[model samples]
Target: MSQNDGTGQKPQPGKKAPSGKTLARRQARTLAMQALYSWHMAGQSLNEIEAQFRVDNDFAAVDGAYFHEILHGVPRQKTEIDGAFESLLDRPLEEIDPVELSILRLSTYELKNRIDIPYRVVINEGIELAKVFGATDGHKFVNGVLDKLAPRLRADEVRANKR
Candidate 1:
């Protein structure tokens, strides 16, 4: 038996419930990932996708601005974001699973544009997103790619952490 961590839900076996801010940010990432997947599959305009998501999902606990930023930013910067870590991929982008690709693109965007977030947090979040939305082993693949991409994009931060 487990106790409710005061969130009206049982905490996972070894994990505490995320703080409100963390939960909001995580919900933002999740919504962004889903929106990205829809955009990739349907070829819809990002604006349409954003508007639809706003209507379809509960945004009350999500960081709406962060979700909006990622949904729009990733596509707007697709070329540069893809180029940033394309060389590190073991396979071509098309060969990669869309779920993994979206997770990668989303995380890579943060690594490149959101300097407020730490590289390790970006990488870890990507892995977590994969575990939830990706293939059985997709988290491993996401980890491998982000692990390589982080040092390249966050060289100073990575090096500082290493010392």
Candidate 2:
């Protein structure tokens, strides 16, 4: 029996499936994380490695340029993101799991760069990614950290938007 057809269950509607843009953003983040993971694993130069990822992953065709922008942008802004994180986290950033670290970096970058994105959505997406990619309890850690950090990271904008 097929997965969806045999359970006597109908697919839920109004669940708000991701738009093409959202899906592309998610794909871009996954690709960027994969690239960063590869770099960490192999210790490759940024230009050499990222170029290879572009070719191998067909990154040019992806829709969410913001994801790629943040992937590259975060490294440049690492000190700021880390400082913000350090101020908010209960423990040092170094103590966090590498997967969780990456999620936080990606989400923080978005929170900073994509002002149009709602802060809650950014936090929720980060928590969801943590659930999938992090160790047990990682989602809680992510949610907690983002909850504290989002207000500071987005600051007056969040207050202005009332999100």
Candidate 3:
């Protein structure tokens, strides 16, 4: 039977069904992680890489606006994001796994800039990304890093949640 593709179209029978986590925002995060990882590994210019990603990826099921926001926003804030993660790191920044680093930086951005989003959600999403994209056992590291970061970045929210 056919499944609903992310873009609101029905998938062809026998085609692989999309995962349950096909919500547009989540898709945007997933894509952002990938694009950020690409930028890190390939050292491509953000504008060129973003343009290429837009041209190459199907955006039907993705939140195009959020995807745009993430890819562009993260690099602009790279110094602060890296500094945040670096403070929480047990090893040198360059030693991190690319996928985990991407997720951590994205999570850090959300924690620092998107105060409307709950810290728990940001940490949880980072964990999920690490689980999906990181090396085996990497999710634990992501969780630990962001768990520490959440309090530093969102002190009031973390304090309130503890109550």
lDDT winner among the candidates?
Answer: 1
Report the poorest 10 consecutive residues by lDDT, candidate 3: 1-10
Segments of candidate 2 deviating more than 4 angstroms: 1-13, 39-43, 58-61, 160-163
- What is candidate 2's CA lDDT for residue 24? 70
Residues 38-136 of candidate 1: C-alpha lDDT, one tens digit per residue: 999999999999999999998899999999999999999999999998999999989999999999999999999998999998998899899989999
Candidate scoring better on TM-score of 1 and 2: 1
The TM-scores of all predictions, comma-separated, are: 0.91, 0.79, 0.84
Model 2: how far residue 73 lies from native, Å:
0.3
Order of the predicted models by lDDT, top scorer first? 1, 3, 2
Model 2: per-residue Cα lDDT over 1-163, one tens digit each: 3223211334346554565576677667766766555555576875676778777776553654654586578777878877777777777777878788878887888887787888988898788777777899999988998888888878886688774
Angstrom error at residue 98, model 3:
1.1
Model 2 clash count equals 0
Which regions in candidate 3 have their CA more than 4 angstroms from the true location?
Answer: 1-22
Model 2 pairs in collision = none
Across 1-163, the per-residue lDDT of candidate 3 in tens digits comes to 5466654557567767556444677788988899999999999988888788889988887878888888888999999899987978999998998899999989998898888778998897788788888999999999999999888999999999999
**TM-score: which is higher, 1 or 3?**
1
lDDT by candidate, in order shown: 0.92, 0.73, 0.86
> How many backbone clashes are present in model 1?
0
